[model samples]
Target: MIVSHPRRTIISRHEQFHLAQQALRRLDRGTGLIALGASLIVGAIAALIWLQPHLAPVPASIAINLMTIGIGAACLIAGWRRYSFHRQLRAATAITDAPMIDCWIENAFEGEPGVIAWELVTSQPDGTEVRLRQAQLIDPSLVTVFQRAATVPVRYVPANPTVSALIIE
Candidate 1:
């Protein structure tokens, strides 16, 4: 069976970035909420410690508040970094034009269910060979297609053509 996807129209980098950011934001909403909740709780605890009577020493309370706040801040930073990494990847793909080529699968191995590592290779017009070897979780339905097809579509950045991936339709 042919594993196919609808053709995607060329999109501007800004628009692509916006869509990519929105998708990533949706995926990370849970983590973001968790981080926000943690931060709010820490803030509330600190506020209570400051405004209400506490048995702990002043210096100890201050230290505890600082530590909790720091942890909350770290969580938020981590969430932001994860979101930003996806945005950066999309931005790079948009900024650079990559040529789509027919790549043959040199080897394929299944890892976890629905995950595969594909070693793929393609040749450029000038006869330079490009290779890609990456493991990714893909739709199970496409496994047969990958096994049967002589070549699959891949795209590579000209600046670093050696690294490539199956074209994301």
Candidate 2:
């Protein structure tokens, strides 16, 4: 499908950064909860060790600490991945001139080319997909907004002319 957008609109880097930051924040909160749970488990184990002095506590405590640290490291890596992806997306300047659309074909299921349509997309309440009479595949950032509102801003590309996706303005 051909994607088209009005001439006046543009997606800003600041907006992309905002979306990425929000996603990172959510991830951080989840990681924090996990860390807290780990801490509680470690405390419980330590108490058990204290109650029975013959049972070695050092090794167990060290293991628990290692596990918690590993989890924290994984969360950090995930956050970094998200940040890098957004940074690259923000760096792409080609989509600025035209409306961007992402078209998912019926076949070629794994890697699909996004078709940008010039039309404005309506956002669904779930924020996972955009509704434009027909739903269009959108970036996670755009989905965040659509999950709240019924409509969203989109941009179309002139070169490819057929693909479009929602862009954060």
Root-mean-square deviation per candidate: 11.9, 14.6
lDDT: which candidate is best? Answer: 1
lDDT per residue for candidate 1 within 1-169, as digits (tens), equals 2122212233333433343333334345246745684876678576756754755456666666667777777777767766554444444451222322211221222332232233345567788886644333445655545554444454444444433344545
lDDT of 2 by residue, 76-141 (tens): 566565454444444443343222322222112223322222333333345544422212434433
State the weakest 10-residue window (summed lDDT) of model 1. Answer: 100-109
Where is model 2 more than 4 Å wrong at Cα? 1-57, 96-165
Give the TM-score (vs. native) of candidate 2: 0.31
TM match of model 1 to true structure: 0.43
Candidate 1, residue 154: how far the Cα is off, in Å? 5.4
Best by TM-score: 1
Separately for all candidates shown, the number of backbone clashes (residues 3 or more apart, or on different chains) is 0, 33
